[model samples]
Target: MTFAFDNAPVWLDLLGVFFFAVSGSLLAARKHIDIVGSLLLASLVGLGGGVIRDIILNTGPPAAFTTPAYLVPPVLATALVYFLFPYVQRYTSMLTLFDAGGLALFCMTGTIKALASGMNPVASVLLGVTTAVGGGLLRDVTANEVPELFNPKSIYAVPAFVGSAMTSALWVFGLFNVLTAAVVAAVVFAFRVLAWRRSWQAPLAVNGWQRRSSDPKP
Candidate 1:
């Protein structure tokens, strides 16, 4: 219930940064961008969401700017992918898996950070989801595509919302801790992987234009 993160795993945050960087770098590789573009995308995807969350919390500078550790993994990941572009592209499934891992990790950490910063539960939940998906949104937009979070054919944001809500609820009930955070993250990650494998989709309304075109002339 208290927002103390004294026992939070440092590795959790590192994993988040690394996997997100991988996903971003892979996207750049797919686009056939040079190493500079790869590194730029890696930085954005690895830190964009956290930057947004920090700005919202008025945390200033963001951890990526303030912490050398936060900056290293993305840069390393970009170089790794840049050099191994063919192998990475050949195994695209890793991208999806890494992205799912990053999403779950970010949601929990983001929520914890917001709550620790004295944010209200509602704001914390929204920020948690933002932290989970914001980086990918930037990556997609930069790639000139609609964000996966907004796609009706994807379950990306739904799982993030669920994870964030679960963490908040646990915190409210005085049951939150590092273990709970890990469990919640795992659950979110599993849901995402399952949804991807099963092709699960959010419901979408038929466009009025499509309906109008199919109707008889009046």
Candidate 2:
């Protein structure tokens, strides 16, 4: 496949896809899935978000389907994971780490795409968050696992929101370039990693009722 992207945003999109594919394949390893299943999971998580974004944006064709280059990453990720499953299974945290990297890149790229398609800032931010989390949601659901998005103990979407918001502002101000995008991704990725390591989480149902880390498991 031809390895090409029209712009830096598309490059970010592809890198994000690759990261998400790795995360999906890692989950397949955890579930003891076969190689084919690993490939399918990787494709699902890698392309699912971009497809959802394009569909919502009413783009003629999703970038995942239109660009042959976009298809290569998932395949490569699956192959890598398939060959490294033994060692991969030992580091369970890698699954989320890859997902966090994807989340960071996708939020910025997704928001940029939405805005480029004439979406309002609010809608772009919403679409950005969707593009970051949709694939993981699909991956978990298909694997019979709870989605991080719905997990009260996870701070998944907040980091996406922050990055998307930053991207949107930068785009509107004409300051969105590779350097700024990198800064946004770094901030989001670091925030996500710290949240995971520190066990930081969003609030629960009620006004102030949340299970603290010190709370005993039921």
Candidate 3:
């Protein structure tokens, strides 16, 4: 469960943070918030999940506090969005792709980090899912909207769960490495993007009585 602090994972993590920050900034723009709000939201979205993960792992202070790499991207992304909100909004597809990449990367890394910290496989997978979606959960709550993970409108958490589980399994089999991580992450990213493109959604509960009441008399 020990992890080597190599440069590759660090760079990949930073890349994911940047993408998450952009997605957060765009969401803030959609809410018509000011620059300060945009930056706050970006930071929340970019680092909130990782902070939660680190805290749960009992890792002191969280990586976000110790490293400027995690802190800088969100600020830069927020500034970019603040000046080019309208331009960024026009490219929804691209934004979604970036978000998917971030989600996949975070899920894999979260799982690895948790396992390295001696968590059980189940807990590691759950932490990975949280790392993938925690930021969006915070962003939604801050904006007073239902978290998308709980919403039936889109496929979000499922993809993260899949990626995290896959990563954990690979670790169990001793098949996990940097290359394997990249491949697993790509699978997750593609799966998520495909789900979005195909409008794949998780099913919602249907109350029979409510359905009957809403139906017209035959």
Collision count for each candidate, in order = 0, 0, 0
* Error of model 3, residue 18, in angstroms: 0.9
Name the regions of candidate 2 deviating beyond 4 angstroms: 1-6, 208-218
- In order of lDDT, best first, we have 2, 1, 3
Inter-residue clash pairs, candidate 2: none
Top TM-score model: 2
lDDT tens readout by residue for model 3, 148-208:
7776546899999999999999888888877788788888899889877776766457644
Best by lDDT: 2
Model 2, residue 57: what's the lDDT?
94
RMSD of 3: 3.9
Cand. 2 Cα-lDDT: 0.89
lDDT for every model? 0.83, 0.89, 0.82
Candidate 2 all-Cα RMSD:
3.7
Off by over 4 Å in 3: 1-8, 206-218
Report per-prediction Cα RMSD to one decimal.
4.6, 3.7, 3.9
Question: What digit string (tens of lDDT, one per residue) describes model 1 on residues 1-218?
Answer: 44457446246667898899999888888888888898899889888988888888896888778878888879899988877877667676778888898999999888888887898888889999999999999988997777888865568998899999998888878888767887998999999988877778665576443323442332
The positional error of residue 62 in candidate 1, measured at the CA in angstroms, is 1.2
